[model samples]
Every structure is written in structure tokens, then in C-alpha cells.
Target: MELKSNWSKTGRISQNLLALTLLLLPLVFLLLVVLLPLWTMLQQTDPESYHMVWQDDFMRRQLGWTTIQAGISTFITLLLGVPVAWFITRIQFRGREWVLRLIMLPFVMPTLVAAMGILALFGAQGMLWRGWDDTPYLLLYGNVFFNLPVMVRAAYQGLCQVPANRLYAAQTLGANIWQRFVRVEWPQMRPWLSGAMCLVFIYCFSGFGLALLLGGERYGTLEVQIYQLIAYELDMAQAGVLVVWALSITLIAGLLYAVISKRTTFKATVQVLPPKTPSAGQKLGLALALVLLLLCCAMPILALGWRAISAGSSWQVLLEEDTWQALFNTIRFTVLAMALALLLGFCHAALAHRWAWVRSITFLPFMASPVCVSFGLLLCYPDYTASLSMLIATYALLAYPFITKDVLAAWDSLPVQYEQAARTLGAKNWQVLLFVTLPLLRPALQRGLALAAATCVGEFAATLFLSRPEWQTLTTLIYHYLGIAGQDNYDRAMVLTLILMLVAILIFSLLEWCTARKEKSLC
Candidate 1:
């Protein structure tokens, strides 16, 4: 008995050491790749850098405009998204699934492609705003288009958590629709709304591709200004200042989201009743909302497709050697990055399940902007900034947070008995992980890989910052063509956007399939 007790103690010690090692591995990688570089950049920055940026009227205006536009975008998203969320959750509507899918397009669509699609619909030469393009409007349009789904999804999830019994009880107690919503539903939804608002604001404030492509020089955001400083002016100090400023805001917002999300627990899962059929007034409201939402979300993409179809010999553009090379590079980078992300995230999630603080470290990369991350890497590894290896590392670092979140959730949801049962059979830790934990994590890992790959494919800012000429991906090529003059260049850009969209759609379809299968298995 004493010998057995000693053996158990020794096993516990070994497991603790293993857990510590797992946590430290990713933490050290993050330090080297993200925090260390950022520290190096900070060392190079001086008060002069901050003074120079602050004194520059253009920089000041850019900062102001970034905040203003982000606020506007968040407000607009809530306005449009909340009603749609209510409709989707509260009303029985035909084609609801299709509408949800339409809303998801922007989630997987590359920002650069979305920018091109916006231009295709609203540029000076576009279908809607011919000869009169407004940059701010276009930027706002892009922000709303991309972020609306986030708000809607969050709101819908929150609404779904409301207890059907409580709602019906309220109705039976002489509560009207508005009263029930205001008293019960509103309270539950507020936390989700706040969280979504924070996310939308951050996304809009950190707008890089949209601001660069649509806002132009006249309406640069902090992100665009930083890009210009690093890529164009080679002003690391100014870029560093901008990074600090942007990250400070991001950190604060992230903390707020963390607090809100923590407090935003739902009641126990209950059977959700079928939604009521809409009245005529509700029908008119839903129609108006759907039309407006469709126009905002679909018009640009449809317009881009039409432009691609109409552009003569556009199909030949895909045959170009550079285009093919970009495609190859994108695929290669995505595969390598996805693999790295999955490995790191799986380990991180496993450790995080035991030690929750590891999550705080992983979340930093998610909150930090891609441009800032790449800039830090550039400052640290100037010679390797354009290296394929460096690009893969950067993509993996950016994507790992998403993977970690998904995998960690899955890890936490799993019962502890599986591992205990494996141990009871005298299986070792590594064997249990391989034979039990990993197989159970397959669905989450698959989802994470798909999301990470989709993100890597659409990623432009970091890729643009880090890539050499030979390292350019399809997105950078599209940016190249869009910057040049001529109808041919525009056509090529549209065709590339279409191609990227198709790839994203394929990945998303796979994700949906995996999710459906998981749900079926659960049922």
C-alpha cells in the first residue's frame, strides 16, 4: 500500500511537470514571436516618436477619424443587426437558413476581396455610385458589411438563451410583447450586445485593408497610418507609437469583453419553442430589413461577379504565371500555418484546461492587430521579414488564438472520466492523450484548422508587410492590380476576388458540414 501511494504521488508530480511544460512552451513561443519583438520595437520608440505623430496634423486627423468611423460603424451595425437578430430568433420565417448563410459570407470573405467588391459596386466606375464615389461612405459600408453578422450572431445566441417558460409566464401574467422583451429578453441580451459592440468597434478601429483600399490617403485609420509609416516611410518610431496607441485601446476593449463575457452566463439549456408566425406588420418590417441587409451584404459581391463576367478575356488573366505563383504561395503558406496553429493550439488548449491563466496569454495575440504583430516581427527580424518561414510563423501566431479558443472550449466540455478510465487501464499520459483526448478533439481541431486556413488565405496586411516579391500571395497580387490604372487591371482584380471568395465558400461549406455532423452525432 505504501509503495502504491508513492507511485501515485510520483505520477501526480510527473503530470504537474508535464502540464507546466505544456503551458510554458507556447508562452515562450509567444514571447519570442510576439512579445519580444514588440519589446524591441518599444525600446526603439522615444517620446520624440509620440511627439512627432501627435504634432502631425495628418496623424492626429487619422486617429480622430478612426475613432469616429469605428463608433459610427458599431452604431450602424447594432441598428441593423439587432432587428435582424430579433426577427431571426423570434419569428418563423421561410428562407431563414439562407439569410443566415448570406450573413456569414463576410465572416470568411477576405477583407481585401470585400474591399474590391465594394469598389466594384460603389466606385466611380461602379454600378451604383458611378462618377461619384465617397470614400468615407465606402469605408463605413465595408465595416457594416463585415461586422453585422457578428452582432446578429451574438444577439441571436443571447436571445436563444432566454427561457421559453419564463417568456410564456410573462405573457400569461398580462405582459405584452414589448413588456416581455423589455423586462426579460433585454436583460439577457444586453451583455451579448455589449460584447458584440466591443468586437465591432475593435474590428472597425483596426481597419487596415478597407481603409487602405477604400478610405484612401484622405481618410486613413491608425492601422493604415502605421502601414504607411513602416512600408512607405520606413518610420519605425512612428509606427511603434501607433502600435502602442492601437494596442492600448485594444487591450482596454479586450478586458471589457472579458469581463462582460464572464458575467454573461446563460441559464440551463431548455427546449426552444417554435417561433410564432409574423403578422402583416411584422412581415413588412422583416421584408424591409431583409432587403436592406441583402443590398448591403449581397450587392457588392453580385456586382463584382457581374463585372467579372462582363470583363472581356478576364478568364485569360488567371493563366498568368504570377497569378498561379500567388495561388501556390497562398496554398503553401496556409497549409504550413494551419499545421503549426493546430499543434500549438492543441497543446495550449490542453494545458489551459488545467491552468486557466494560460488563456490570458493566448488571448493577447487575438486582440493584437495583425499589422502590429508583423511590424514587431519586422523590427526583430529585418532580414527575414520577407522569408516564407517567417510568413508561416506570423500566420500561425495570428491563427493560433482562434484555434486555442475552439479547442479549449471543446476540452473543457469533455468529461474527465474518459482520461480516468484510460488511466485505470494503466495507459500512460501520452498514450491517453493520443488514444483518447486527441480523437475526442478531432471535430474541434478540424473546425479550428478550417477557420485558421480561411483566415490565412484572406490575410493581407501581415502578408503585405512581411512578404518579398517572390512571397506575394493572391491578395497582394489583387492589391497590386487594383492600385494600377486600366480596365484590364480592374478586371483582373475582380476575377481574383471571385476566386478567393470561391475558396472561402468551399472552406465554409466544409466547416458547416463538420458542424452538422457533430450535431447529428450528439442527437
Candidate 2:
């Protein structure tokens, strides 16, 4: 008995040590990577700079347009995504699952790829429309293309939470389909969908790549303006003020999203009704969904492929030594950043399981724009801004939250009894975690890793800001081509964008396959 007590005491000490390590590591990383840099940025800013920045008419217009464009995008996305989500969730049809999967394609697509797709279809030399010169329209289309999936997925998840029994009860009370939805479904979905709309607004408002590419000289948002101020004007004070304003706007949106998201609940066992075949009238609604999906999701990718095939001599860009070096850099940086993200995320999730507040730290990156993060890095680590380490660390900071969020969700859903049983069997804390927790956590880790990998690969704004000429990634390469004049360079940029898209897709597929293989092994 004394031996067992001593062993348990030793185990407790070791477990405490492990917990402290996990807790401190991620916090330290955040302190250096996010907090300290942001603090430095704040220190460099004052009311005088803010006043000077706001005095500029261009700055004020950009801020107003940023808000206006985000509002428009959110309204349009909700207008399209909700009905489509309702159609997919409430009505059964052929290829329904395929449509659901198709929505996810946009989530994996890089912003640069989406921009290329739009330019291919609607630019001055566009395949479909040759005279579409309205930059705001182009920017709006890009925003919808990227954000509609978020709204659709959110609505679908929300709609699933509506109890079928309640709907049936409403129907029995003589409520029509519309009436039933208004009375029984809308309330359940409102919080979830509202939260998603906030996210869409945040993304659209702070988007850098689309605004930079599509906004031309006139329609750029605060993010693009910040980039221009830093990169072109070399106006750090103005950029810092813009960063403060951008952060303030996004932070408010993020808090609202959090509050709305908290009101939503996922049941351990939801009583979902099997979908029924659509009626003739419902088929019209389904057709609208099909049209929206094609316009918003499929158009960009189809356009990319169409343009890539025609990019004949531009394909020679693939043979350049510079292209090869950029490709190598992209792959190496993604691998390194992904490893760092996994480590940070793993520690974060472990700590978050013990203290719920720890989960909030991961959301900081989401609230702050990538441009802001890069600029902060520039200020805090001036000498290291051009180094590979700074760039990779920036990538990890943005990417790790996906892993943390996924792992935390998995941790939350885990049964406590299994861990308790191991403890009762005289298993040390580390032994239980290694043998029991890690296995169950594998699926979540894989999902997070896939997302983190994709994020690192597609990262553009930070890379653009922090990367030196010698350290150019594929995204930076694409941007370089875009900056140069001539049809050949434009075509080359499209080709490079296609390559980046494929890399992201391949990473997602490989991780997903690993997850499936792991599941099979467990079975």
C-alpha cells in the first residue's frame, strides 16, 4: 500500500509538471508572437498619428467602403446561402451529399486562386465578359465566392439542430411549410447563422488579397491600405493607426460572433429526420440552390482550369529556376510552419481542456488581420522580418488556431469515464494520455493538421510583407507576376495560382486519407 501511495504521489508530481509545461509553452509563444508585437505597435501609435491618418480623405473613404462592402457581402451570402442550406438540409435529392462536399471547395481555395478565377472570367481580356471594368463588383464577387460556404455550412449546422418532432407538431397544428420554418426553425437557426454572418463580415471586411488584386487603386479596404502605407509609402505611423482601426472593427465583430455562437448548442444525440424527396414546388428551390452554387462555388475553379489550359507559353514559367526555388521554399516553409502549429495547438488544446479561458487565446489571430500581424512582427523584430524564422512563425500563429479549435472540440466531446478508469487501474497521467487520450485525439489532430497545412500553404499577406526576395514562396511568386505588366506575366501568375491551389488540395487530401486509414486501423 505504501509503495502504491509513493508511486501515485510521484505520478501526481510528474502530471503537474506536464500540465505546467503545456500551459506555459503556448502562452509564451503567444506572448512573444502576438502580444508583445501588438504592444510594440500600440506604443508606436498616438492620437497625433491617428488624427493625421483620419484626416486623409482616402483613409476615411476606405474605412467607410470597407464597412459597406462587408455589409453587402454578408447580406448577399445570407440571401443565397440560407435558402440553399435549407434546401440541402430539409429536402433530399440526388447528389445532395456531393453538393454539400462541393461547398467545402471554396474553404480550401486560396484567395489568390479565387482572384485569378475572377480575373479569368471577368477581366479586360476575360473569357466570359470582356468589358466588366467595375472593380467593386469584381471584389464583391470574390468575397461571395470565398464566404458563401461559411454561411451555408453554418446554416446547415443550425438547421440540423431543429427538432423534426417540433416541425411535425407545427404541421399537425395546420402550419404550412413557410409557417413551420418561421415558427419552428428560424429561432433555432438564428443564433448560429447570425454568428456565421459576423464571421463572413469579418473576412470580407479585412480581406487583403482580393481587395489588393481586384480593388485596383480605388476600392481597397483598410487591409490593402495598410499594406500600401507600409509597403509603398513606408508610412509606419499611418499604417499603425490603420491597424488600430482595423483591429477595433474586427474585434467588435468577433465578440458579437462569439456571443451568438455561445447561444448555439449541439446535442449529443440529435433526433434528425431522414430527408424526403422534394416536391415539384421544392424542386424550384433546389434549382435556385444549384444556380447559386454554380455561380459562387464552381465558377472560379472552372474559370481557373479554362484559363490554365490556354496559358500555353506561360506554362514555361514552370520551367524557370526562380519558379523551382519558390516551389521549394513554399513546401519547406509549409512543412516547418505546420510542425510548429501542431506543437502549439497540441499544447493549447491540452491547457484549454483544463481552463476554458485558455481557448480564447487562439481566437486572437482571427480577430487581427494577417497584415496587422506581419506589420507587428516588422516593428517588434525589425532585423528578423526578412528571416525565414519570422515568416514561418507568422504562418504558424495564423494556422495553429485551427488545430487548437479542432482538438479542443474533440477534447470536450471525450468521455471522462475512460480516463477515470485508467486512473483507477493505477495508470500514471502520462500513461493514460499516451495510451488513451492520444488515440482518440488522432482524428481531430488530423483534421486540424490538414487545415493548418492548407492555411500555411495559402498564406499570402504575411509572406508578402515579411519575406525577402531570396525567401519568396509560391504566393509571393504569384504576386510578383501580378505586379509586372504584360499578358504573359498575367498568364504566368494564373499558372502559379493554379499550382498553389493544387498544393493546398493535395495537402488536405493526404491528411484526410491518413485520418481514414487511422479509423480503419482502429476498426
* Candidate with the greatest TM-score versus the true structure: 2
Candidate 2 per-residue lDDT, tens place, 1-523, comes to 9999999999888879877887789899988988899899999988677776568887889899999999999999999988989999988888886677557678778888888888888888788886666668989999999999989988998888888899889989999989988998889889888988988998999889889888887888899989988989998888899999989999999878756654665664668757888899999988988898998888988898878878999999999999999999989999999989999999988887887666556577788889998999999998786888898899999899889877877777777899999999999778998999999999889988987898888889998888888998898899888889998998898888888888888988889779878877877
Q: Whole-model lDDT for model 2 versus the true structure?
A: 0.86
Model 2, runs deviating above 4 Å:
1-15, 516-523
Locate the minimum summed-lDDT window of 10 residues in model 1: 261-270
For every candidate structure, what is the RMSD over all alpha carbons to the true structure, in angstroms?
3.1, 2.4
Estimate, for each residue in 415-467, the C-alpha lDDT of model 1 and write its tens digit: 78999999999998889989998878777777777667778888998888888
Error of 1 at 76 (Å): 1.0
TM per prediction = 0.91, 0.94
What is the lDDT of every predicted structure here?
Answer: 0.82, 0.86
Give the range where candidate 2 is weakest over 10 consecutive residues by summed lDDT.
259-268
Shift in Å, residue 117, candidate 2: 0.6
